[model samples]
Target chain A: AQSVAQPEDQVNVAEGNPLTVKCTYSVSGNPYLFWYVQYPNRGLQFLLKYITGDNLVKGSYGFEAEFNKSQTSFHLKKPSALVSDSALYFCAVRAQPYTGGFKTIFGAGTRLFVKA
Target chain B: DVKVTQSSRYLVKRTGEKVFLECVQDMDHENMFWYRQDPGLGLRLIYFSYDVKMKEKGDIPEGYSVSREKKERFSLILESASTNQTSMYLCASSLRLALLSYNEQFFGPGTRLTVL
Candidate 1:
């Protein structure tokens, strides 16, 4: 079964410091990984996706993620954290099995708290 | 830019009432999804539609149903609303590809439904 795990329930980072949100996946075949952000009382917005391309994927709001094939990890990163960047982050995965069915899975989520 | 819109931002209903949540997307996406968001649980997929009149059960399909009679619109139905069903419902749409699809979903603002 394809599944995603966001080990951290919450992360606190200081402003101007680099931030990293961890994500790991388990899938039989190649994985299609994605990062999404959701603010308080708002819907989720797509951040970036890794589908068989360069490992480094840049997304909106100057965020980027690195897809580590061996480690089966796609971690979301930002050069510098901002107070406004504090939000809930989610990692998702989609894969096709040998039998030919598409399965998508989402992590429990990581709440990022950027401290000023 | 792709835009997904939900019919209501907030709703309150009594227990056992039949509830309907409507969603519309303007981008002409071939795929639409319904999810419920809760604290710590992240987003749980309830149902998805690959095309008009074609629906697939997601991870959490019990206690809810979906309708996609039109391409642009998708509706979620709760036969009898209960307190456990109170949640933030999200609607998302993405383009369906011929091959193994790996597309980022665009989400609506979301509807916060409260069941009493």
Candidate 2:
């Protein structure tokens, strides 16, 4: 089974400071990881993904994530936090099993509060 | 640009009432998915369809069903709305590309359902 875990329930950061949201995953096969953000009353917006490329993957809104194989983690990061960036962050992992059917498993989201 | 739209922004229903949540995607994608988002649960897949008229149960499909009679439209059905089922429903569509590059899943704005 493929599953993800977000250790933090919430994270607080000052505007202009760097931000990080942690996530770890367990999958049977190769990992296809993703990061998404959600605002209040809205759905998720794709942030970035890691398939087989560079460790650091850049995504929308100046967000990025690093995939660490040894640690089994894919943590979302931003160089400088913005107050508007306060929202919920989700980390998802796809189990690339040889089986034809597969689904993405998401972590219990982490709420981010960026203070102005 | 790929866009996904949900039929309603908010809905209120009583117990034992039948509820329908519709989703449409502008992109001609082959895969459509329905997920429920809770505060700490992040997102749990309720159902998914790989093609027209083909649906598959997801992680949490116990109280819900899905319809995908057409390529662009997917509808989630709740036979009896329950208070525990009150949550934000999100729809997503994505092309079934190679496993290495299929992490991009476009999502709708989501519908908030409250069951009394």
Candidate 3:
């Protein structure tokens, strides 16, 4: 019943310009959101997450995401894009059932291309 | 740091052959997961184990089975390798049920399996 969606199949950004990868979620109760990045021929690495507290979460590689409660969106952002930042980005959500424990759901992913 | 490692980086197998993919984690995580990754599908969970010898079916578990005999190792098995099963397989681990826990999962480099 819980799911996450990445709106873009691909995003092209010029170096030194801001970049964003949009994600939205549908879940029961409050949502636990996450961002992950995968380089070419590599596994995914955790970037950031938002469970409680601040809506603006800062993560590795100078990236950050804003969790919008009203819009049910968590978007990954960078002040300036870099060629190295070009990778596959996946948005995920954690589901905590009343019975305890948790499960994770991942989005289809967004391919980010940063042109230098 | 938590390190998750897969047994292989690349593998080639014939259709109908039994394929085994092994994974191990340095961290004594409570949860271990096997995921299948395709170009547009993102990460589809095949199976996950919350504890040693305890496994649960995930989103896509039709042709896959998993084993978690030890706390640090998890193995995924394809009963009959099909062309559709040819994809990247990723292993991951996470800390849960502990005093200090986050739903973040650490992933291995991944194994690219090609079933001909």
Q: Write the per-residue lDDT of candidate 3 for residues B1-116, one digit (tens) a residue.
A: 88999999999999999999999999899899999998888898888888899888887999999999999999999999999998999999998865334579999999999999
Interface RMSD of each: 2.3, 2.0, 2.7
lDDT of 2 by residue, B67-101 (tens): 99999999999999999999999999988875444
lDDT of 1 by residue, B28-66 (tens): 999899999988888888988888998888888999999
Clashing pairs in 2: none
A3-111, model 1: which lDDT tens digit per residue?
8999999999999999999999998777899999999888899999998879999999999999999899999999999999999999999867322325567899999
Q: Please give, for residues A45-114, the per-residue lDDT of candidate 3 as tens digits.
A: 9999998899999999999999999999999999999999999999999876422345788999999999
Q: Who is ahead in DockQ, 1 or 2? A: 2
Each candidate's fnat, listed in order, reads 0.63, 0.63, 0.58
lDDT of model 1 at position A113: 99
TM-score of chain A considered alone, across all candidate predictions:
0.93, 0.95, 0.95
Residue B41 local lDDT, model 3: 88
For residue A97, what is the lDDT in candidate 2?
A: 32
List clashing residue pairs in candidate 3: none
Which runs of model 3 end up more than 4 angstroms from their true locations?
A98-101, B98-101
How much is A87 displaced in model 3, in angstroms?
0.5
